[model samples]
Target: MAMNGETKTKAKSNLSKRGSKALTPFSPYIDAVNQAKSCQWSPSNEEGFFLMATAESVLSFDLVHEKIRTCREVPATVGLYGNFRGGDRLRSAIAKMMERTFMGVEVNSAHICISSGVTAVLDLFFFATCDPGDGCLIPAPYFPAFDNDMSIRNEVQPIPVQPADTHTYIPTAEEMEKAVVEAAKRGVKPRVLLITNPGNPLGTLYPEATLKELLLWAVNRGLHVLSDEIYANSKFGSSPDEFISMEKVAQNAVLENLLSAELVAEFVHTAYGMSKDFGMNGFRVGSLHTRSKDLLNFWQNMGMFAAVSNDTQHALAVMLEDENFVDSYVSENKRRLKKSYELLTTNFKTANLHFMSACAAMFCWLDLRSVLAESTFKAESELWKEILEECHIVLTPGEACHYGEPGFFRVCYASMPPNQLQVACDRLTAFIEKKRRKRKAANIS
Candidate 1:
């Protein structure tokens, strides 16, 4: 075959074969969804699937029918819309909700920017705060989406802060500081610090003092703070007063003493939404708050790239403005979450399985080293796959959540019914027992 110079170059390029990171391991929950199609596990087809990896509200969509009826009775033109294509009314409503409930410190609506949801807000943050190749400091065992969002789309480096103890699963402030210091030494100079409140995969909330110290350190380092406060409302046994927003801390006089003296107009952006707290994942409404005009303008420009849907904005506006609705929704969500926690705790205790504290959020981080320690599986990811094949139950491997540590998995309690939770736990116990027996037989031989 005749080939031109260009063709030869292309052929050589193809043969060069640059490497890319491996595709994310298949979601076990997705595998469970596929298996549910073949097995008759529950009375109704609707109830059998347990794929709840997203922070979706279990009850958020059920109220939509009622909302539809309510909206019909009101005037069609009653909806709020500002003159601009992407106005600040929706942003104002979200700020009001946060001010009244969690933060209690008032913020101007003009200072907030509305986005599709928390993910959109995060995307905007990366675009605004980070240049390509800039690093973002993220505590390990974070929400996997953050790592994916920063690394894949934004092309920013993730400086991981390793946990002090994999067994206890707590993120230490010293470790976080060390990671940032090391990154700075390596010339990455992390521009932003991302922290998930009420923690995601680990399920450990930071103490007030620890949070304040970290905020001060970031301020001294001239780093912008990105606080993902979507899980703010899920804290158990704490008054709203106990919940402190980093934005609020930056404005506090007492904490300012420990921070930089430059009066640097410390940049702090808070991301809030209804998906996790209100169980309204479909609403797709979330807002980002910041005091920096530069950051605000950056987001405002990015808003042109992707904006929240009109109907979702209206629905979220109604929910945010109504004190009664917010109160009722929050109380009901807490009740449901408490029930889920109780069911999972009881099952874990009874099965003699070890799990981290479920202080808040819908998941329990389980240490599976006991099971993996005896198995022939050389990799924890492979062990996760084996568990799914044997037990027909799904779990998120710890690595997916950015904890490189082996022998840990995240169990979401919010998706499963109490009975199903018990059944899954039982199945897990049986699987572990079988593995133990096989190991014993091998030892005897």
Candidate 2:
């Protein structure tokens, strides 16, 4: 409790200067991960703690395993070094997948670069585009790992674009421009604009108009736009707003003459992987789509350090090549995600807890501000610790995601079975009710 996510404390150490500097003072995300490793709840272990803090999905592992079993035979080319960028078949498969899912944008395999994961893809991109101390404009309440991913080794500074309205937490073009101006005042050179489509934690898609506005702002600023579409295919529920890729937006802008073709070609880029959408985090496979030749060459040469294994690439390519399997797998995964979401939200409604209505991604942005003792991040962290210790469940605290305000938590439903998630919800409701009763009792006294 003393080492909350908001506070930073450093101790004297013999570690390298960079390593010591990278030591995060508080990380509810990493703490939850370690906790889950030791005492995670499952069907076999009913008494164990429920880990609803992570963003992984285990609902469709059976489906993935069954399909992957058929692709076990590796090619002879896999024995020796093939393409360091990525295997030809895998890149081609990814291109097609992007074309189909990213709203009919024609993706060429030649423009794609593969790495071990989206984290690595981003690291490589930032390392190439930014000098040390260059700032990247990212909307706050974002994926917390982005801080370490872009900053730790790349030495890039992540400048948070605080939203005018924290309730939605979606930044407007005006807000982004203001953030860039603020960064300039602080002597931070802004280089890139990062977007997490079907946004992390929020689990909502950017309205098409908002997406266009943000992209055009980046174009005007001559900043590279890196769209993280890791959750592109995991969308579900009844949101009428469709998921639009950054590539399509930029292409349309160029066609409309709102943005120059050369600018779009050089600046618009996207990152994707099998981790979130396909529930294939263990695969360690991710790809970047870019039209910039310089970026492609940089990553192509540097990718050797982070290249995915040929065997992994071959298996994923096989999975992607099968239309029926990929389609069925995606549909089934969505159905399961929807069911899990409903299971969690149904309990929330019963407890009268407020949460952002999410239509994509695996998170439910739950509001516990009413239950907090005060309206501060400290209170939020205290509530998070209370829930973990008392209910034996792990929920990502708002401060962990660098949310603008307090008492909001990112509850992941897809990490465990629906039945297990139901147990987690039950424990959370009981905790909420207990707090409500205590407040009422104190008021009466």
Backbone clashes for every candidate come to 1, 0
lDDT of 2: 0.87
Q: Cα lDDT for residue 339, model 1?
A: 79
Q: What ranges in model 2 sit over 4 Å off?
A: 1-10, 23-29
lDDT of 1 at 266: 44
Best by TM-score: 2
lDDT tens digits, residues 140-224, model 1?
8878767666765576888877777765555666787788779878778688889887778756677676677777777667788
TM-score each candidate: 0.84, 0.96
lDDT of each model, Cα atoms only?
A: 0.67, 0.87
Q: Write the per-residue lDDT of candidate 2 for residues 1-445, one digit (tens) a residue.
A: 2222243447776789888877763364575556555867777876678777778999999999999999878878788987889988999999988887654699999989999999899999999999999999988788878888988898999988878986667789999888888888999999999999989988999878888999998989889999998998888878868899988998999999999988998999999999988889988999999999999889778999899999999988988989888888889999999999998899999899999999999999999999999999878878887887788788888887877889889988999888788888888899999999999999999
